[model samples]
Target: MKHQKELYKEAMTVLKATSRTFFIPITFLEKELKTTVGTAYLCMRAIDEIEDDEKLPNTIKAELLHATSQLLLKPFDRNAYLKLLEPYRHQLPEVTLRLSDWLALCPEGIRNTVASSTSEMADGMAKWASKGWHIQTKEDLDEYTYYVAGLVGTMLSDIWLWGAGIKTDRELAIGYGRGLQAVNILRNQSEDKERGVQFIPDGWTRNDLFQYAEENLAKADQYNKSISKRSILMFCKIPLALAHKTLDTMRKGNNKMTRKEVEQTVEEITSE
Candidate 1:
């Protein structure tokens, strides 16, 4: 078995390569929080890879997602687990292949949190994938976002409280997660359409989606304001600031933030 430091180095490598946006705030976390949150992010990213692979049949994706969730709960079985995951292995990013390693490195409480949240996300993904990734109404959109994102908010809140003693408003934290995810949906609207995944309800224009995202962001602002610790506040603020900036840029028809812009935003948040 790899030592904790080696495992953490591997996790950070995967995190930085796969999700630069998240790496920023995660880096701001204190040591234990950093490892736990990084592990959680990598765990979710693993299942997300399976769910998002366009080449896989929905049935196969559902099976793999379910299996991945199950593996996280049981003791690690290298041979059996890798065999089960092998077919989808090539399709997923390298970090996802190290899921067991990530699980092994998590502190017990955080591991349980990661396992439960990942299981819930996998179950939700399987259900939605079976239904053809459709969002037919406002309720459907909310449910979909909750599955893909809001549960993440709740998981993060649990982690924050456990790791740092920071109590977060679960409802507003869910809104924070939904706001960031809504921004992603809006930014990737065309790409999602190309993949036959329609997150937007019928009769909802871009403006409607924007309105929904902004309202959630307003709540996210409240969620951020509730954090008192400097490290935790900065950790929360970096992403929330970027989400707002991304939404603004999206409304102006420029959805991507330049590296300089991202750096400036992080610098501003960390300095405050």
Candidate 2:
């Protein structure tokens, strides 16, 4: 087995490769807190990659997601995951293939919490994948976002309280997650349509989605205000600021922010 330090180093490498938004804030976290949040983020990203794979059939994705959920329900099992993934190793990304390492990176006390959240997300992804990611109502959209993103908020709240010695409202944390996901849906609407997935409800307009994002972002603002730890506060602020900027950019007819704009936003947030 790799040492925890080695696992954390690899996790950070994967994180930087996969998500600049999270990598920025997570890097500033204190040692153990950094490992805990990094572990959770990588684990979630592992399953997310499986859910978003273009080449895999929905049935195969569902099977992999369901099996992953089942594996996470119990204690960590390297052999079981290896056996489960061996058949489609070539089809999956390295993050998904090396899920056992991410899971093992968590400090033991918080490992189960991270695993359980990831399991729930995987189970949710499996359901949506099996259903062809159908979205025809506001409720349906909410459920889907909750599974994929809102639970992320809940998990982070748990981590904040556990590692940072700060507590926050679980509901507001969920709003933070949903708000970010809604912005993503907005920014990716064209790409998603090209891929035959529609996050917009049947009759909803762009304005409606914007409204949804704004409402949740309001809650996210509240969630950020509730954080007392400066590091955790800054951690939450950078993403929230970026999400707001991205949403505004999309409103102004841009697909997404430029790399320069993203860096400026991060700079502004960190400098404050």
Candidate 3:
């Protein structure tokens, strides 16, 4: 658990330093949701690493995924899993290096909480990614994202118990995670399609990505309204703002449009 704190710090540091777009929104959730975000990122990144590893043989990828599923029941398999990532280990120095940076900014107690939580998250993620390629239905997508995103929602609730910072509405917190995952689903629609993965619910399509984006924003309404404190609401506005920006683009822009002019239009809308 102590070591997990170190790993958690490293995860956040890497994300904070190398990722500009993710920095601000994450900061808003810093105290409570920070651990939630860090652990979620590690889990999501593991899936991304496996799926995005173009250099690995397909069988190895499948095997790794399978191993990951086994690991969910035994999280210490992280060391073994990390070993499997040997080929790309050199490229991952920053995941550790950045931890040092984030550690410097963290208070001791919060750091420990972040660490234990993140370690569990990393292990759970490994377990999930091991089966990440098994998406056969929309329900599977929800379960998967719940493993990847909604779990973070529950964690956000846990972190909130640490202080009286926000209204801490559980429904809204759940909404936050769903909305964020919805944003992720929409943004990665093309890439996900290329890989035979679909995170949107049934009856949705690339053609309806924008419509689904609206669904995401609609999903967020409870969360946005759940904030009773204006100050906290203003601070919490970051993720919602990003969700709105993402959904607004989805509404006005054609995700399937590949023409330079059309893509540019989408990009322009997304930029807002």
Candidate 4:
């Protein structure tokens, strides 16, 4: 058998490179797992790249995900999406390079699991983009976030459960994922607006959103504290702070969410 240590090291190298590159704090979590935390991070990182990528038209993005998923059913062809990413090669995270190497060496089972899940995440994204307009209500936002991020919550909970010391508070952990994503949506209101995406409900205006943001931040704090894993806690904390800041700004009638606010939030959380 190939060494588990080697697999883990590759995974963590990818994890470290991906998280820092993407401004995520999730990697501070490696110590809690008995097995491949590295693979988990790499898999999740790839998902993050897709979700955060603002370049492609919605349909193309959906097609790319469909292709990625289909390729995963077989062996992953590294070159398949390599070209798509090449123009922005300098922008690729150091972790993705390590992830490529790790993908080659990973246990078939791990690779299969990660690959399959990535496909599902992509499929869900595709379905969301084209058909989302059919969803004409606030209830739609709940389902949409669940498909995009709440599912990440479930996936993450499963990962933590597979590891040691997870202390699974199933509802609580998933709440962190859902709440965190919601906070990001709230914070990125302007950017999303530019893309013609509206995450919050039409019924909820600025003041109502402020109250909702405050509510979610509190949920994040509660969930992070309820969970035993320090890594999960660290990951949860950033959005909690962002929600906190956004809520505060809303109180002052600061309607615009700027890059400066995001940078300030990032700095504040990392320093802690």
Task: Pick the lDDT winner.
Answer: 2
- Model 4 lDDT per residue over 1-272, tens place: 34767766656655555554333554455544423445554665564565456665667656655655576667767786676556555654655433355555544545566566556766766677656324446577666666666666666556655554465565655555666666666667787788777677766775565555556456557666766655666665765676566666656777444777777777777676
| Model 3 ranges off by over 4 Å | 1-13, 26-87, 91-93, 96-124, 131-134, 165-167, 201-203, 206-216, 228-232, 254-272
The residue-by-residue lDDT of candidate 1 on 209-257, one tens digit each, is 9999999999999998878888778878898999999988887889789
Off by over 4 Å in 4: 1-27, 31-39, 73-113, 132-135, 215-218, 229-242, 253-272
TM-score for candidate 3, please give it. 0.62
What 10-residue stretch in candidate 3 is worst by lDDT? 96-105
The collision pairs in model 3 are 4-115, 5-115, 10-99, 65-130
| Full-model lDDT, candidate 4 | 0.59
lDDT of 2 at 116: 98
Residue 147 displacement (Å), model 4: 2.6
Best by TM-score: 2
Query: Compared with the true structure, what per-residue lDDT tens digits does model 2 show for residues 52-158?
Result: 99998999999989999999999878898889888888988878888889888888988999999999999999999998997999999999999999999999999
Clashing pairs in 4: 11-38
lDDT of 4 at 42: 63
Please list the residue runs of candidate 2 whose C-alpha ends up more than 4 Å from where it truly belongs after superposition: none
Task: Return the lDDT, model 1, position 209.
Answer: 96
- Give all candidates' CA lDDT scores: 0.86, 0.91, 0.54, 0.59
Between candidates 1 and 4, the one scoring higher on TM-score is 1
